[model samples]
Target: MRGITLALDAMGGDFGPDVIVPAALQALRYYPQLELLLVGKPAAITNYLVKYNSISNDRISIVPTKYIINSEAKPSQAILSSQGTSMRVALELIKVGRAHACVSAGNTGALMGLAKLVLTPIAGIHRPALMVILPHQNNGKTVVLDIGANIKCNAMMLVQFAIIGEVIAKQIIGVVNVPRVALLNIGAENTKGFGNIHQAAKILSNISSINYIGYLEANELLTGKTDIIVCEGFVGNVTLKTMEGVIRFFLSLIKSSDDSVQHNFSMNTNIVCNFSYMNPDKYNGAYLVGLCGTVIKSHGAANQQAFTTAITQAVKAVERQISKKIASRLAECWITTE
Candidate 1:
C-alpha cells in the first residue's frame, strides 16, 4: 500500500494546536510511511512544532485556517455557516482527495454533520455511525457502534450498522474468521429490546455471510461473547459512558483500600497497568463508519496521548482501505438506501 496522508484539525480540541502538533509529530516519528497536514493558524502550529523540536519538514506540513469550531457550536451552525473552521477545512482536504483521511478531536455533533455533508455516506448508507473499540475478556477487543451518531434508527439502518461493524472487525480489528455478531438488548432473549432490534435480528439471522449470534445484554458486552455489538446511538452512548465510569470507580477503590504500603503500591501499580486496557485514551478515535472517505472523531477532551492514538487509528483505517472495503461490501449486499 502507498503511504497514508492524514489531515488534522489542529485547533478543535480543548487544548488546541499546542496539544495536536506534538501528537502529530509523535505519529510522524512512529510511522515513517505517514505524513500529516495540520490545519490551523500557521503561526500557532509552527510555534508548537518548533517547541516540540520536530523539524521533520518532509513528513509534516501546515494548512492555515482562520476560524475554529468551538466545543459548544451546534451541528447546524457548523454545517451551514462555519465554512472556514479548521474542522471543516480538514474534512475538505479529504473531500477533494487531497488527504487519505482526517482526524479531529472536535465536537461530535459538528463533526458528524460536517462529515456527512462534505464526505457524504457510502452509496447505500443513509447515515454514518460512530464506532469504538472496547477491551474484551482475555485481553481481546470488540467493536461497538452507533455510540452517538443517530439517536433514532429503523430496522434496516440497524442491519446496515451490522454490516459496517462487521467490515470494521474483519479489516481493522483483524478478526481472522467470521466475527460473531450480536444486537445489544435488555435481555439475551429474542423478545427483548424494541421491535426494531427484533427485526434487525431476523435480518441478520437470514444473512448467511455473518456469524449472527443473536441478542447480547449490556453486562455481557465486554465478556468477549461476541465480536460486534449493535445498538442505537442513545443506548450505545449510555453503555459506553457507564462502562468508563464503572472501571474508573473500581480502579480508584482498589487503590484506596487499607493495606501495607509496599503491597498497596505494587497492587495499585498492577491494577493501573491491567485496567489501562479500559482507558478511553487508548481508543480515543471513533470512526464515523459508512462515509465515502475516512473520518475519525477523537474525544473533545482528549489529551495529547489520546489524540495521538486517534491519529494512529486514522492512519490504520486508511491503510486497511476501510472506506473502499465498506463500499464494496455494501454493493455486494445491495441494500437500498433512499
Candidate 2:
C-alpha cells in the first residue's frame, strides 16, 4: 500500500492528548506506512509522547497551535475564532495537501463548519452529510447518513442523501447488488411521514439508479433488510445515540448481574458475544462526506480504542480515495429537483 499521512486534532476530544497520543502511537504501529501530524500544544502533546516513549518516532510530527475550541461553542462562534485552534489547523493541513485526511473528536458543529470552509464541498453538492456504517443482525452493514450535519432537510436534500448513501454503500462498503435505499420514517406507509419525507420518497422511487425500498421504521434499522437508511440530521443523530444507549444498557445488565445469573448467561456465550458487536466503540468514526477532502468525526467522549478506530477510518478513506470516487459517481448520475 502507498504511504498515507493524516492530520489529527490532538486537543479536540474530552481527554485530549491523554487519549489521542496513545491512539496515534497505536495507529502508527498498526499501519506501517502511516504518518501523522499532531496539531495542538507542543508541551501537552510531548508530555504524552514521552510517557508513551515514542517521542523520537520518525513517522509522527507535531504542529503547534495555541487555541482550543470549546465543545459548547456555536458553529459561527467557532468559525470566527478558529484561526489558531488545533481542529482548524488539522483541517487546514488537508486543504493545503499536507495531509490526505483529517480526524477530529471535537465540537461537531465547529468541525463541520471548518471542514466546509477549508476543503469546500464536492461540485453539485449543497452540503456535506455525516455518515457511518452500522452493523446489522445479519452480520452485514448499513450505511446511514446526515447523522448531525443538518438539523432539518427538504425533499431535495433527503433525495441527495439517498444518492450519496447509495454511492457509499457501493464504493466504500462494497455492496455487490444494487443497494437497497429507504427513508427512515414513523411508519412504513406512504402517507406516514411529513410532506418532505413523502416528496423525497417519490423522487427516490423515480430514480432508476436508486433501488428505493420506501419507508423503514426505527425498529428495522439493524435488521439488515436495507443497505442505506436516509434521514435528516436531527432524526439520524437521535437514532444513533438511542441505539448506543440501548446497547450499553443491555451490556451493563449482563455485567452487573448476580453470580448465578452470570453463570447462566455465560452458558449462552454466543448471545453475549453477539451483543459485543453492538458496542458503539466498534463504530466510533463518522465521515463528514461530500467534501473535496476526507474528514472523520470521532465521538467526543471516545476512549483510546475508539479514537484509534477513528484514525484507522481516516486511513481507509484516504487509501480508498473516497471523496474522489463520490465526486465522480455524483457527476455521472447527478439528480436535481428542478
Candidate 3:
C-alpha cells in the first residue's frame, strides 16, 4: 500500500500542540507508511516534538502559521478572518493536494465553514454532514449523521441525509446486507413529526433503492433495530450530547457504589467490559462527509488517545476513497436538493 500524508491542525484544540504533537507521534509509530504535516507555530510544535524525541523524524514536517481561530468565534466571523490560521492552512493542504486528508480539534462552526470553502462540497451535495458511529445494543454499530452541520434542514435535505447515511453504512461501516435506514422522530407513528420529517419519510419509503424503515424514537436509539439514523442537525446534536451525558452518569454511579457492589461489578468481566464501550474517547472523531476530500473533527477537549483515534479515522477514510464512493452512490439516486 502506498503511504498517505495527513495535515494536522496542531493549534486548533483546547490543549493545542500540547495534546496534538503526542497524538501525531503515536499515530506515526502505529502506521509505518503515515506522514504528517503539523500546521501550527514552529516553536510550539518543536517543543513537544523535542519532548517526545521525534523532532528529527523524517516523516514529520511542520508548516508554520501566524494565527489561531478563537474557540468561540462564529462561523461567519471565522470565515472573514480565517487567513493565516492554522485550521485554514491545514485544510488548504488538502485543497492543493499536498495531503490526502485533514484532521482538526477546533471550533466546529469554523472548521465546517473553512472546509466547505477550501475543500468544496461534492458535485451534487448542497451541504456536508457531520457523521459519527455509535455503539449499539446488539454489539453492532450505528451510523448517525447531520450531528451539527446544518441546524435547520428541509424535507429535501433530510432525504439527502438518508441517502448519504445509506452509502456510509455500506461503504464505511461495512454493512453486508441492505442497510436498514430510519428517520429520527418524536414517535414511531407515521404522523408524529414535523411536516418536513413526514414528507422526508414518505419520500424515503418511495425510493426502491433504499431500505427505508419508517420511524425511530429517541429512546430506542441503542436498540440496534436500525443501521442508520437520519435527522436534522439540531435534534441530532442534542441527542448525541444527551447520550454522552447519560453514559458518563452511569459510569460515575459504578465508581461511587459501595465496595461490595463495586467488587461484584468488577468481577463480572462481561458487564464491566460492556460498560467500557460507552467511553466517549473511543468515539471522538466525527467525519465531515459529502465533501470532496476527507476532513475529521476531533473533540475539542479530546485527550491524546482520542485525538490519535481521529487521525486514524482520517487515514481509513482516505485509504477507502470514501468521498469518491459517496459521489458514485449519489449519482445513482434521482432525488435532488436543488
TM-score of each: 0.95, 0.95, 0.95
Model 1 C-alpha lDDT per residue in residues 1-338, reported as the tens digit of each score: 24889999999989988789888888988999998999998889988988987755778888899988888878887678778889999999998888999999888899999999898998889889999988886777899998999998888899889989889999988899898899999988777779999999988888878689999888898899988999999999999999888886876676666243545576677877887778878878999999989999988888889999999899889989999999887776654331
Worst 10 residues of 2 by lDDT: 329-338
lDDT of each candidate versus the true structure: 0.87, 0.91, 0.90
Ranking by lDDT: 2, 3, 1
What would you estimate as the lDDT of candidate 1? 0.87
Better of 1 and 2 by TM-score: 2
The best candidate by lDDT is 2
Off by over 4 Å in 1: 254-263, 335-338
Error of 1 at 284 (Å): 0.9
Q: Give the C-alpha miss distance for residue 121 in model 1, angstroms.
A: 0.6
Number of clashing pairs, model 2?
0
Q: Which pairs, if any, clash in model 3?
A: none
Tens digit of lDDT per residue, candidate 3, span 214-320? Answer: 89998888999999999999989999999999898877766666344656664555655787786788878999998999999999999999999999989989988
